[model samples]
Target: MEEKQIKTPHEVIASGGNVIKTRDDHSLILVGSDGTVLNSNECSWISDDKDNAVDNKLFRSRIEPWLTSLFQSEHLSLLCGSGITNAISSLAGAGTGTTMGETTFTNYKNEIVSAAQESAQASGREKGNIEDQIRVANDLLRGLKIIKDQNAAQLEKELNSIISNFAKSILNSENGIATAEENKRENAYRVLVNFLLSFASRTGNKERLSIFTTNYDRLLETGAELAGIHLMDRFVGNMMPIFRSSRLNLDIHYNPPGIRGEPRYLEGVARLTKLHGSIDWIQNGGEIRRIGLPFGAKAITPYLEAPGLDNANTMKLMIYPNSAKDRETAEYPYVELFRDFAASICRPNSTLVTYGYGFADEHINRVIHDMLTIPSTHLVIISYNDPIGRVLSFYSESAHKDQMSILMGGNLGDITNLANDYLPKSAIDRATIRMAELLQHRMGATSGLDKQATARQVSIVADVSTSEE
Candidate 1:
């Protein structure tokens, strides 16, 4: 038997000739000014006293503070992909959570299947997922209607059935989350709360965080509620929230009682945009709106399923997965949603952080690519593995390599490990930041003169620490 060959990080880097990519062997890797690799010597990382060796701690120490500073950028946005959904789904929910799996019926009208396959292949996918099927079906349905084809009604019926099942599956997946307590195998919920709060916890002075997700699940909403974070989105309404094209650029703030003329932005308020549309969103009488769906629901909401209503059918779920569709539809919500995304991240001093995103969506990736055109804007890619070489390819093709930061490997991408080991506390104290600066100044002033004794410098550090406490 022959042993399979696996390339080391050094080999991967050399093969690309400076286009460093994520390692497939699950070795810890970092790219950028703070780059590090923890591969070749796993044995050395183990010791009698410590589970994670001193070197491992050192690697983490560098990245954590660096990430902390990046999160405090003038404009910050987080883009989430299906990686997060899979991470959450791994937990032991009471019932099977939403799987967002492939279409149940492989049997499609021969022409329809051909078009769908072509659509999937155009995007580099081997076959269309449920979203692809749905979009293709709709497009085909429209064409048939235009030509007055006799099969239009039949295709519409199948499309409706596919959508009904898809929406119900989404509801089921979210409901499964409610059945969970603490998933003992991996407490993803605990880490999820921390992961969200870490980025969302801006002081009143910084720009409000913008969180966008391709996922249709409501995990972010649920997580925000649990963390006591306020989310402002484009949808307006309470009973049945309508997606408005034009609304005031509103925000949440509070005024300190003693200070009459000034107001402070409320802490932890982030603008949420579901770029691919959400499962809860639907179109009724030519207007898009969000319906009330409880987390971990037992059935579709009565408000949505009411028999007489035009959109009472679950087929109206606003998830627009098939990107191949034309963006010219009347009142198209995706264009509006994407405009929010582009406007949020493509500005000066902006930082976009991606978690669990595989970079599969070309539409989203194009915006990211354009954002990097601005020398000041930055991107941070954090994922367990590249799966395909998309992550590496994006890095190599970028004109501004210095503006990108990447952390890849299984340990770094795990929600729990990322939250606990890498993320800084929710709020880093301003006084502590100042005290460190003071210490650095003291060290610089005393370095060359003190060769034998360091008592004075040590005292200065202690005094600074005492002041911080």
Candidate 2:
């Protein structure tokens, strides 16, 4: 038997590389940032077992210290994708369904699958599988829309249904069931919101919390409103609010009336940057206008064909799933919005904390990878399943894994259990302390993920005190 070769981070960087791309030996051999080879294949920071469980104190002990460290940073940003919405939807009694692509193109699934089968038969090889064919059909539909052909009518109709379903699903969760006692369970959104509130009280840092989400839903908006927090989304007008990118650049500062009072920057304000177009947004004469009505109310108008071409504009404004997304993102509003996301990642001392986001989008992933190369930047990925398999090749080939932290499985589920746990406590002070405990214990760690990365600043800890954060 021959001993396998391993590469160190220094060697990888000295070789004019920043990530570990691959290995000649296809077997599972874990490599550290210092280039040490270990028998294990999992990331040093996370465990491999799907059923491994950690108590609330231990889970809190693991997450809180890291969160505390993040709070210590002058610049911090939170980036959320589809996973957060799914977690909330599940909590709201709406079961998670097929991907947005499958839901939108449900009517053409058979046709697409048949086409793939025929192509395989013609080629006498495994060519377009069902998934591949579905992708191709979606791309074809997107191309038709881009060219302004009438053939995309069906695609538009299918998209309307998907948007309406998503709207209704998210809106229903707005009222939300009481989960105060259930706080001990790991609910992503619940803990995220609570953590933001708690951190705001502990730190006088007046810097606005930049929340960048890919979802078009209004759950977070409603959540913030219900909590009585100031959420600045850059739409200024009251009667008919229009999105202005410049408004986000403006800051609010308060000066004390007394001579000795120091000027204070307003805290607890969050700037929401919706990278993908929001359901409430409609383009009028090239300007993005927002409807003050609820998302569910606005989402169904396209399907009704209510009044005239004016009403039809709402449905046409949606950015559908599949290949068209890249092109749609380049258009007005989205282009500006995506630019904000890119800029947020590059901020100094910026720690990009992600929840429920799978690094599926190439464009978004590219920005993150670029940011990692810069100094004083960190990436924390918390997922219910293996979060690094798709990026393992990239990590293995690069020398920049030192700033990356991957937390998978255990109590790292999309929603904090405490988010669902509703309890009755009249004692505000005591309940606050108990609430903190519940939020910490309720986590859904990554589970059922295939492969894991184990190089660089990664370590697996059974005890919560192991982290220095």
Best by lDDT: 1
Expressed as tens digits, the lDDT of each residue in 72-158 for candidate 1 is 678999999877766776654434345544564433556666776787677655666677667777777788899999988887788
- Number of backbone collisions per candidate: 3, 57
- Give model 1's TM-score versus the native structure: 0.80
Error in Å for residue 376 of model 1: 0.6
Task: Give the CA lDDT, 0 to 100, for residue 321 in model 2.
Answer: 30
| Candidate 1 stretches greater than 4 Å from native | 1-5, 8-55, 92-101, 104-108, 181-186, 306-311, 325-331, 429-431, 434-469
Local accuracy of candidate 2 as per-residue lDDT tens digits, 1-469 = 1212434333322332222111122322233323233333532332446322224443344454454455445566777777676665565454552244333256566666666555444433333432345445656677888999886897767645555565554444433422222442224345546634543332234356778877766766755665555777767788667878684376555775773566665645667877766666666655677766553342345443433225544345443332123564576666777788788778677777776665555567767888887888877665544333433444444566667654433233335542322111112323443444354467434223311211111221111122212
Each model's C-alpha lDDT?
0.68, 0.51
Q: Candidate 2: deviation at residue 300, Å? A: 2.9
Worst 10 residues of 2 by lDDT: 454-463
> Candidate 1: lDDT of 69?
64
Model 2 residue 202 CA deviation (Å) reads 7.3
Q: Which ranges of candidate 2 are over 4 A from the true structure? A: 1-59, 97-192, 198-206, 255-263, 295-299, 302-309, 321-328, 387-398, 417-469
